[model samples]
Target: MMDNKTLEKKAIAAECFVEVPFFDLDPMNIVWHGNYVKYFEQARCELLRKIDYDYPQMKESGYYWPIIDMRLKYIKPANFGEKLLCIATFKECENRLKINYLIQSAESGEKLCKGYTVQVAVTTSDFEMQLVSPDILKQRLTDYISGLS
Candidate 1:
């Protein structure tokens, strides 16, 4: 198993500011743990969009990538109306795409939660598993990285 520091090394982040809602709170007036998963999903999708290669595009490309593994760890509690920023980073792009996540208080920068997800590519038409991701994904990453240079 990899440690948090090690996982952070393989990520690309998309920061999101979320306003906690009344329904997101538990009986304790803190954000419910399950709600964090939604935030993670939101940021993950945004990060994929940054690369112009998200779920819809993946399917259009004749592939289907599913979340095969996921994990979350809650460190602190956030209350209703609290603004929090979520960072979704890419952890791995080889074999499968792994993403690491971090949620922190927008005001105090206190870490609220951390997690990771793993997704594997599969053929959409025949449903055959792909040992390597499609070339479009690799090309997009390459172009995105080059644009930064």
Candidate 2:
């Protein structure tokens, strides 16, 4: 199992806002469970962008990182018009990128859901799986922060 503290190290944390639309609600008027996955994904993407290593850039680097594992847990239900704050952070990325996510009510700061995704690197040229991440990711992350500091 991945530790929260370990994830925090490689994490590029980010927050995202999501409004629960009426259409997204089920018969009980609570946001459907399946929608939480989408929310998690949106926040995870944002975190990746902070490190300058999102999908598009990964593609350009001659590798395709595909999600190979994922898990989610919902603790509460959200109703229509409810605003959610999605938080995403990296858990590990030495051999693979494992991202952990949390969804909370924007107003109450109450956690509604939590999840994680793991992605492995694959060569785009021949679709060969890589045991370790390419140097591009490390270089991009280094340069991104150096430029900011």
- Shift of residue 141 alpha carbon in model 2, Å: 2.2
Mark the 10 consecutive residues where model 1 has the least summed lDDT.
1-10
Model 2: lDDT to the true structure: 0.84
CA lDDT of each prediction against the hidden true structure:
0.83, 0.84
Clashing pairs in 2: 7-91
Model 1 residue 133 lDDT?
68
Candidate 1 residue 91 C-alpha distance from true site, Å:
1.1
Per-residue lDDT over 55-112 for candidate 2, one digit per residue giving the tens place of the 0 to 100 score: 9989988999989999999899998999999999777766887888999999999999
Give the alpha carbon lDDT tens digit for every residue of 51-86 in model 1.
888899999998888899999999999999999999
